[model samples]
Target: MKKNIAKYIEQFEQTLNFSDLSWWIIDYKNDPGYFYCNKVMANTFNLDINAQKHSVVDTCPIAGDYIKNVHLASTNKANLIIKEYLELLNQEKKEYNNTFPYYDKNIDTVKYFSSKAKALELDEEGNVSILFGLIENITSKETLSKELKEYHNIIDTNVMTATTNTKGIILNCSSALCNITGYSKEELVGQKYNILKHPDTSEKVFEKMELALAKGEIWENEIKNQKKNGEEYWIKLIVSPIFNEQGKIKAFTTINQDITDKKIIEKLSKKDKLTNLYNRAKLDILLEKELQTFERYETNSSIIMLDIDYFKSINDNYGHLIGDKVLVQIASILRSNTRITDFVGRWGGEEFLIICPNSDIENTEKVASKLKDVLEFSDFGMKKNVTASFGISSYKENDTVDTLLQRADNALYNAKENGRNTVELIP
Candidate 1:
């Protein structure tokens, strides 16, 4: 009988050797229980063949309480497979499944484990023997899941309207983004956001966009972008970044609102109510920018200041209605003669200012002469060959806005001095 029992024990040990799981058989009824540990279990407890006679408690001091609990559960034949015990084991078999303070020589750090324990019975003597368990590492998983959920929520709930990200790569976009951009989720992924860049948008503005994104800065501004149908519209965009576990930027998110109608209203605000020419407010802004460009690039530019000749007589004799028609007709002539780059604005009542960027003194005189000739050939209802006298001044370095306007005004006096229907350059 003893020989057969030893053979059975050897066979059981051999069976455990074939698997990766760690296990051990404990004789609970015996004082200082007998332990038959598999290779994995033996390694876990740092036990050798010579240490077989020692109790499990003596060999694995950290797991002493866990073994005692399993023994107590075995006395009642309670099932304990992966059940929580006071001593918990982690996924790594090198450590006990317990939350006790212990120094790890390998990692030089303290760690904890929550383990699952099971009771196994062998023999009819009611001698509860064997405890089985498995441990899993969950610290990193718990932290990562929490952070990922937070990031997902932010991307999913963006307000405003348009889709954002460089190249339209929708890292995180809201329903509003999809609606405003006219692109489905599947269509927007990995696409350039600038695919919507409007033709009217200057290249310089796009360069700023690239610079801002590259530096990890938010870019908030109004930009003209195209729709899926190639129609242009304006949007106010606020673009920001998304960071990952190590604080590295992983993606970009943008909130945008359509502002085309607002932009139209703004443009209307800068125009003269009657003639539709830009008003003085717009002219001042244009002049200031052009002057800065001239100073920076050392470019030549000219200003033509002019007024309709004898405008009071027409309003008094022919009524304000005819005067209005004459003004509209003059505006149409000016618009037709000027290049698209020139700024033509109504400088309050009959007076007009034409800014010619990159035009020299001689070219300005020629343009002014052409303006006088064209108006002379055109006849009004009863005004009979209405004319305008122009004062031209070429921009010079260090000239302030007031100085430039004064020079142009002096040139107008010269034009009136020379002849009412003639053009003259300021001396």
Candidate 2:
């Protein structure tokens, strides 16, 4: 309302577009008194009425020459209308309405306007004193039509985005979304948002997301989604709820950021660089978790600490490169022969640790014994068979990680004392 009343009137003109009044007022004998036009007036002429009581019209760009050149044609026509307003006042007409085309110099555009002028008060001779005017911008309707087409083009040029109904049915998806998901717009639209959800994403996770969104909160999560080719990919998903006038849920919008490479790198970080088995650090995390499980439940777990017998001699004879290959072979054998519930890790050079959850001392000994027989028999592509000595210890009641590991290390020393390729149990 402050900047240019004309522009405000034009913007809301759509609601009152069919209505007659986009109001303006003028002094019958002077400049345009009070004028209001909507966006069209701003777009066309950059026209503004001065704060003075006299009806003076000014063009923006504040420079004298640009203002004079820009508003010259429209200002002259408006002044002529003011002269006519006075004549109508003297003729005693209540109001006069008409249409005119103006050449707008700002953007070099041609605009059309429908205007109605009314006499406010009359002089002693019954002459018109002040005049009221209403203007409807007919050209702005065409301008809005052109703007909408350009807006649609701009929106589609960005990142992967999509929209859906309140019930989660897909309404539309961008081409970028189609390219990433390997689905066409035809295939994606009308489908539920879950069409791309992976089976690994549990229903509980979806329920939690739905509950958050229902309360009008934005929900963000990393989703493991399946592509059309059945290959899995990772994405950071952000969903926002669209609200209607009545404060009711209208629809939803989702933006996706592809994070497949990041997830792959994170997985590699937890693995041993040489053997690709988990490194010692990762093994410690799993071990602590197993201990926590034992603390909560009375169920037992065990650990096996082992190292290759005369591994330095093997490295010396065949070179460290061959030593690494032999270790990788040993690691492979350990991985293939162990149960899924067990964990085998490369516990530093020439050493390995096996975590056996739900296993007692007797059961742990059997596992280590099996690993020993495999190491003794498995071919290492070397002149002699490689041997590994294992020390087994099970979790005792209220035992800490340090205590359990110390007992296993002690037992491993005894296994070496008792000779290699033997499984020794801690008391």
Candidate 3:
């Protein structure tokens, strides 16, 4: 039986092709054992091929005590599988870590087995043998598993993270961060995030950013930023400090959301759909702002309320198409004639209001007369010309926006009653 076991080990050694595996068989009752090793295993410990004998303990130096424990367990009729890691010298005298599994039974210990080994079996005649098994080095698989776990962790992080230093030089960024600033990863990696700052953003915004960052307090705000194409956008930015091991702020992590579309829809809600001009709702808001400015600065301002003359007749004569065309033309004229700072909005059907800031009754009348003359000569795709009646009212120190609008409206009614295509001032 012993000779047959020795032949089996020799055949296994010749068949096994891997260079990292070693095997040994131990007699259950004795400390010394007959060991068989492959050419690879012999080369691993720089052992001579012709060496007459070798000890399992000598070959696997670090796991010597673990092997003895398995041997003791095997002699006690225990079916045991033991696994351990050992540092051993290789062919080049270099130390390498290797894993070994041992199976023990009543008669013997089988050493340097594979992780697949379960237990050892003893024949009725008392010969011990390892169950069918094979060893495969899985170091590469273990290393790859560790690396893949790390990669997944990097992908799962939520920091809208641009890798920028304190000087605002960007390095790397996460996809969430890239999506917010309207920049692609390639475009933003090396550039400053401040490139998205809008001209309308005040110094106070920067002051707040610096103050909060200096105090290590994360800052959050709904801020306006510009896109790569010079289009303005808004985002809710939350900037937090990224600290180093020294507890010093190394970088700032900023998370942002694109809110420009929402803001635009909000602004559009305040505008007239047909004329694309500010609606009455927005006019109310603007009037209050203008009135407050006038009160503070003592600025002379006036309101001009105008309505198209015979507009219903035009719509009746030439379908609503031409009526719409006339309205759009008048809107364009108002927009063109008003100063950039002046407010022009559609008050209602065929009626429009103009707020001329820093303008008195004289300038308002001049603007109104100009509008009248322009409309009187303008063609609305009809055989004849179109005109409008203008009513002007100067803002009183004690007057409200509604009161000023009402006075202009009253004058407009007086103009339509007296004559069409003329300007009238509220008494």
- True-vs-predicted CA distance for residue 130, candidate 3, Å: 22
Task: List, residue by residue over 1-427, the lDDT tens digit for candidate 1.
Answer: 2223245347667775676555554444343344555566555444675555447555542345334444323423222322333222222232234322222334544333334444444346633333444433344554576689887666555554334444556444566566666777667666676666788888898688668877888888999887777777788978776566997666677777778899889988899988999999999998899889989998999999998988888898899999999999999999999999888999978888999999998998888899999988988878367899999998797988888999999989887887788887873
lDDT for model 1 comes to 0.69
lDDT of 3 at 63: 39
Q: CA shift at 384, candidate 1, in angstroms?
A: 5.8
Candidate 3 stretches with Cα past 4 Å from truth are 1-168, 180-183, 194-232, 238-252, 293-297, 377-383
What lDDT score is found at residue 427 in candidate 2?
Answer: 45
Instruction: Please give the RMSD to the true structure for each candidate, in Å.
Output: 12.4, 11.7, 13.8
Estimate every model's Cα lDDT from 0 to 1: 0.69, 0.76, 0.70
Clash pairs for candidate 2: 6-37, 6-38, 7-38, 10-38, 24-133, 31-55, 32-55
TM-scores of all models? Answer: 0.49, 0.57, 0.57
- lDDT accuracy of residue 322 in candidate 3: 85
Q: What is the C-alpha local distance difference test score of candidate 3?
A: 0.70
Candidate 3 local lDDT, residue 161: 55
How many residue pairs clash (N, CA or C atoms closer than 3 angstroms) in each of the candidate models, in the order given? Answer: 13, 7, 0
